[model samples]
Target: MRLSTRYLVPLIALFACSSPTTSTPAINSSAGPAGTSVSSPSSLPELAADPREPFLAKAVASLLSEDHLLQRKIDDQVSREAFPKYLEQLDGGKLFLLKEHVAALEADIDHLDDQIEAGDLVLARRGAALLAKRREVVAKVVADVLSKPFDFTKAETLETDAEKRTYAATEDELRDRWRAVLKLQVLERVEQLEELSDALAKKKPTDEDAPARPPEEIPPTFEGKEAKARKELAVRFETRFTRWKDMEPLEPAEMFLNAVASVYDPHTQYLAPAEKENFDIQISGTLEGIGAALGEEDHFIVVRELIPGGASWQQGKLEAGDLILAVAQQGEQPVDITDMPIDKVVKLIRGPKDTTVTLTVKKPDGRVETISIKRDVIKIEASYARGAVLNLGKGHEPMGYIYLPGFYGDTRGASKAPERNATDDVRKLLEVFQKRKLNGVIIDLRGNGGGLLGHARDITGLFIETGPVVQAHAADKKVEVLEDTDPGVAYNGQVVVMVDRFSASASEILAGALQDYQRAIIVGTGPTHGKGTVQALVDLDKLRANPQAASAADSLGVLKLTIQQYFRVDGESTQWRGVVPDVVLPDPASYVDSGERSLFHSIPWSSIAPQPYKVSKHSWTAAQLAEASKKRIDSQPVFKKVEAFSKALKARRDDTVVDLKRDDWVAERKRNKAELDTLDPKLSETKPRVEVTPLEESAAEKTAPKTAGDKNVKKRIDKWREELGRDPWVEESLLVLEDMKKLK
Candidate 1:
């Protein structure tokens, strides 16, 4: 989450000049003619009164309108914008209400700010109610549609991009949309089944040199496959409905709260209790859970990804893309969750810090296994900085590489030195590098989302002797310049900082400061994730508390507010436009919709007067180096193919509509796969499917014989080491370091 706030009068003038903000709420005339069958904005039904809302309203109104560090006011213009934002938040897919329903409520659009001000949620409640109604109707309509096999030969298309779509005119039309969606799903699945059947029939090649038969299924006769797909899809829909039914009552309120929160800035949020705890866990870099981010896929709960230091990540047995079959507690029968909702499955998986849960998993290669995993409090090892000494050439040139996954601080508190922070770890690694007499060093910040700002300052201080690291301007026109107080340079060697599009917030801060100071050759993708704003989390309980007694609404969540905007020493604000690297690398994800600019209502970029700073070192002539690197890449066929693949992927991403015709749909799928295959083979090599190390297996701490947890940890280390070997990003960074060494 990245953000910012107001400050100097010039900043005020900048915002004011952009658009003339309305003082009073104004109704948008574009809603419709006044005499149309649709009623006026004021006619929307009133929300039922709740006792807690008054207190909640008082807090929200005060925060967004006045108390926010930005002091941003929710005037008529902002409110009108909220109407569409809130609608999109609820139904961006255009899956629920009809245009008539939207028109019926158009009268409410202009009046949303008033309700937000008055602590009323009539419009929000209406949207929620309509979604609920639609969900129920969709379940039934989908069931009815799936009762018969889909006509794959039918010439038709369905708009996949919901943003470009209009609401259906009636419930029947909505059901038709649902029917088409189910048909597409069924068709997609039958194709999968066809491929699976063909692969099953083919015998494995005995010769090691011979390649396996291509998975291209002989044209499916469509025989009984469509019926089987429909049946399977019907079961999946049943699970979806069950999952929808399990929706918590507070979810709508939470969504409404977020809708209001985003209006202030994207980073500012009202963290519910569970959300707050999760936030704390991320900050502390420890938690008690499976440590895997799970998602519902094809009616089965699947492991979408794993946290580096999380339990699931430690257990190398549970791989990403593996479908979770069932979950069982200790000494209990495994409950088959073929059609079970994900939340319920998660609840079963997460438990007391020291317990056991068995997960039945189906791997991508069709292997099935019941893996018992001990639920230990997982410390996110990946979140911390790890070091590797790379030998550049056969001449045995050694270079130190430290990968900071996030700007994690010593949450355990600094007793002697700084605790388990990225700064302290980097300092240790740099010390080791000095001992080894390395040629150059690479500080890889790729995919690092960022954490503590203080850590970033201290980390930057480790490189530069002393100077201003970052400058923050609050809404009250107060400028607080954060400087590197430590007058010590740990690493004076030639340096290269590696970053990517995902390097944001604190990551951007450190990279920006280094680039400005000319202390390091910033290498990798251009413009890191732009998030140069500061958020201060305030507990609602503390705000509402009296000196002696607290309010009963302490159960209400904490509010993260955008307090200030940060600027680089060079005065550039990394808000919409993040820090550009000295040497821009060819990134596969460059074409993807990413960074702060992609966010709705992100603050505009600005500049303050640049702070006075000195450059300690300058080895590489950046322009010449960048030009040389660009030529090296542009001339290569592999890089050229990658660029083409990226363009094609982005084009497919932009093309929202998908053909419903089975032949067309299948053909489109094949075309994409073929195109992807034609590109560099390494493009398909996503992440290393790795195993455990021997060190993790030597678990002397546990008295019991080889437990699943111990074995899992060992397997994970093997994968981690293997990943380090195959990582092309790391390879590129080393090459950049070599380039830096040659520069004079």
Candidate 2:
């Protein structure tokens, strides 16, 4: 798996002010026992070593000190902050060592800023040596614990949130902690095996008149299944332990530097050379794989987001929060991926197009299922600004729909012939609707995470006459106003913008501008994701001439820095508090804490004088639309079921501790599955099993030689059309459009 760089995504307008600005305190204490453990600095992680250590250090210092838009000062306060952050970066769980080890490392906490300023990392290196030693101690403990298994009924609990707990006070306490951890793992797998055994005992729904019979090769007893599960779980943990033993200095150095960058913003991060290349592949968006975004949480690779036109979404089997347990090729033995990093999981899932990959995943409800997906070129079809007609019955008015997954454009390409972009694609769709005499249009930007700023402005221009859409400002007070200069409004009879908490950056920009002018009725789950900042990728290799440094075994990586802030035309910066919609809908994401406010060191939200823009042709108060939608939701059965599921999902998310008791745990999962089943009926209707032909294209237009990619895209179009009738959110948005139509 290739490592990817983290970018600061400000989702809220947060102001940071704390920790006193001061010089380092005078200390008479010399190097402590922590520093003495490593006689020489050569013993540090191998990858952490850089022949141009001084040069790299100075280069980073110069950027943070002078070039960064934030221009954060690295004083004694910053040193104090970096101390604990770097410690967490090394060992957040406190599983490796006792309290004394942490105390020893704390002795040099006051000098980290000074060390960085001086272009020396001796203090960081000393801390790294202690961490390496602690890891070795724990590795041996894990090996011994996994050698044998027992005591499933020990009635012990393991606190999974390591950051919230204190360090082990003694070696005995640390060993006990490790034991509890292993017990929990064994209990989880035992529960899974029990479920599997029960599943095997039943006849599949498709088995026509077949008798309920277990497979001849498999074990039927509970104890036998438990033994198999335990052995495999232990082996997986052992493999992870081996990887820990292979850690190098480079890993620690990267972690430490990334921690420093995080102090400014969680998004600002250091990327290794290999990781930088991976980042480029990700930006390209055309990858041969199952089409899913993988992220690590609590050391488990979880499904983050399914690419709209990818195999995962098309399969409609996997969901966000599903824990990927193992990966297998066509006929190979399944390889457990528990505790493996996300990059490795990606490499395992990706393969040549048309190849088959099977993923064993544990659902959020604790139900384990194996998803078999054929790998293909996963492209962002929704990101292409696609159009479809939402059916509203035989006699009802035809409502047009467009799902803009992102404000995408050829930012890196020369805007040459056949330049495909979000704005252009959308304009073409609007023109198509104009010819169709559509009653209304719904622009869906539910999961749009934003893209090019230029496209956002042009997209917004398509709705309104001439007006300012967004404003960009630098720290030096340089301000630029981006506006829609054209007065030609495209198909402005009625407009509705569909958005969600995932809509961010340029998505927020376009949504905010249209809502401000009352040009469109905004209908969504809630406020947009408050990511109102811009990032510019800066290459460390290009920062200076001949930056030939002995930086580990790879070339220097790139830095994605937050360089500018974006504000809506209404004078409000969409930094922290994103754009609020006219008609709000119930969403599971709203139950969770998110947006810019959830982040640390986020830029504060402020307001400037509002820019002048033409009033919307259709004048209607939001209360009218929201009130109409509310009335509709009060009696909506699908919405009622959706609300119940949202409550259940929230409860499950907040309560991280799983019931260790097998019977109770299985019962709990059953209840969750029962609750999910009610929504499944509606969900399955939208995401059908079979492929669908587009309703808009002419017979001749639809006859193009369809590739696998084309079919994948058609699924998205078909599913959206299906959802136009089943999805309460879309139904409600269509209702909102009707209310706007009446008011106008």
Candidate 3:
């Protein structure tokens, strides 16, 4: 609950197009008052259609200009940069807009800043209208192109990278581009079907667990497969178009405002009301809803996964893969949701706690049924900390492993103290490990992107005595050192903090602090994700200066603004260049072009005066442990295959042009699969190197299920343990821990 009201550290980034402002001004009428009228492009409609839009635009501009960390002005240069980004947001694939349409849209690009300042979104409207028109045209083109059979023998290539291509010159050229795209999609689907068919044919009757393909379900020939692919593509396109057309008015506004906000930095974004709600859920790891994660599949809102203890899970009838056809409040008519946007569908299904909502669903086997369930608080268990004991054969000492997906805390809790949080959970796990007398602990933060910043500092304090955890540099050049004043340590044992390229923000803070204090050895494939800045959600409704705008304040949404950049206690900012781990592992994921450095307009890495802090006493040095690890890793066959696969993957990523010819495409896919098959099986099918079991007390709770929801929870935990037992990274860490004990 520390510094809960201060700032939020999130893992997201943006470009500068504006002149620097000499001074930061308070939110006022510098951009003009609400409902301000100014000259705009003659072709575009007036802003009076949506009275709230002008006020929203003015508020966002004022906030960005006055409070953004960059303090950049909204000017012509920013407009020039933001316009193209806005265009990209509309059609990043470059599939819909023609060259002429793009030219027309770019006509007033330079004047977008002026339009925004005056509360007239002429360019945004034009771009949105053009995109709508292009989508209608593209839909027809897709239908026409798919109506005819493709010439599979014709040799051709398609540039899959949109950045490498330009807008089509004419309608014919656009149609031709669509033809290539459709052809490629159909080709991939046909090849996939063929591969599945081959696998099924090769499967022996003795293979009882193998999935059985009904005789009617299998496409007998290549022609039949191709036909099936085409039909699927048609349905997919129709669904996609319907979804796009159904987008709310505020969505386009959000995109334009985000483009403007991103000009200052990547993390600054204008979140629509719905997006703000989703972000809150992500940080808190809880929501009031049906508890089913939904995804779109050819127009159907298919339930992807059911959250354990959620309303859907408790209901028992609703399940993963079930199609939600309609939703209704209790005693109300069910509203058909075919081809509806996922967000809208979610909104309908999510309601107040104890409220009964009904769902009309189509089961996987095609049975239709109506289900009613009372909504409840759904806690996302995956986001919390989980612990397991690792038994490494007979010679090595048992070690404890804690997997923290994020630094989650209850956002709705009181600012001074949270009822439940990650720090408390991790502390409990550490206490359990302390009692067991575990030799070493592994804090697995592999894919943790970060959440609440307070938890990061408090979690770091759990491993060390009181000290400065991180330094925050605000926009006004003021520095605030966030320290752990808690005088005692939670667990002062040998520790290894596991990270990866995706470990970001709060993750970086904890890892960097631990590494700086020499309290833990860092282990990862590469540097952590370099997101050093902190963002805070500012409700635009509160910043309305004009009394006229107050009536519409509720719909104004929120702006996630970057307000501070944090640095490690060692003085180095983990902005672009993240914390370097002590022991670097050979991982194929390392080959990915990721992290903050890969992002555009990310803040550069810098250093501040290092804070005075005592380093914890450690018996073994990182170099000694790393040297021993490298020897074993080099000779490991799995790692060798990983190295080769990494190279192949890098090569594959570099080659953006794909062959459209059926035979050539199939051959390319085969070659790619052959390369992957070498390493994929080794990574997934390796025998468990260590025995992973739950904590003694939690074992009963995990295995003994009292309800259907608890049964699902048990299955997930067992699967997690099984996967962890087979993980090479975890195995490597166990070996490293043994080295730490012996090398001393």
- What is the C-alpha local distance difference test score of each model? 0.67, 0.68, 0.74
Q: Write the per-residue lDDT of candidate 1 for residues 542-563, one digit (tens) a residue.
A: 4453512533223455567777
Residue 59 error for model 3, in Å? 1.3
Candidate 2: C-alpha lDDT: 0.68
Candidate with the larger TM-score of 1 and 2? 2
Best by lDDT: 3
TM-score on alpha carbons, each prediction: 0.78, 0.86, 0.78
Q: How displaced is residue 346 in candidate 1, in Å?
A: 4.2
Candidate 1 error regions (>4 Å): 1-47, 198-225, 235-252, 272-290, 293-306, 309-379, 413-419, 545-554, 683-728
Candidate 3 regions with alpha-carbon error over 4 angstroms: 1-49, 192-228, 273-383, 410-420, 545-554, 698-708, 711-714
Error of 2 at 550 (Å): 8.9
Ordered by lDDT, highest first, the candidates read: 3, 2, 1
Error of 3 at 68 (Å): 1.0
> Weakest 10 consecutive residues, lDDT, candidate 2?
11-20
Q: What global local distance difference test value does model 3 have? A: 0.74
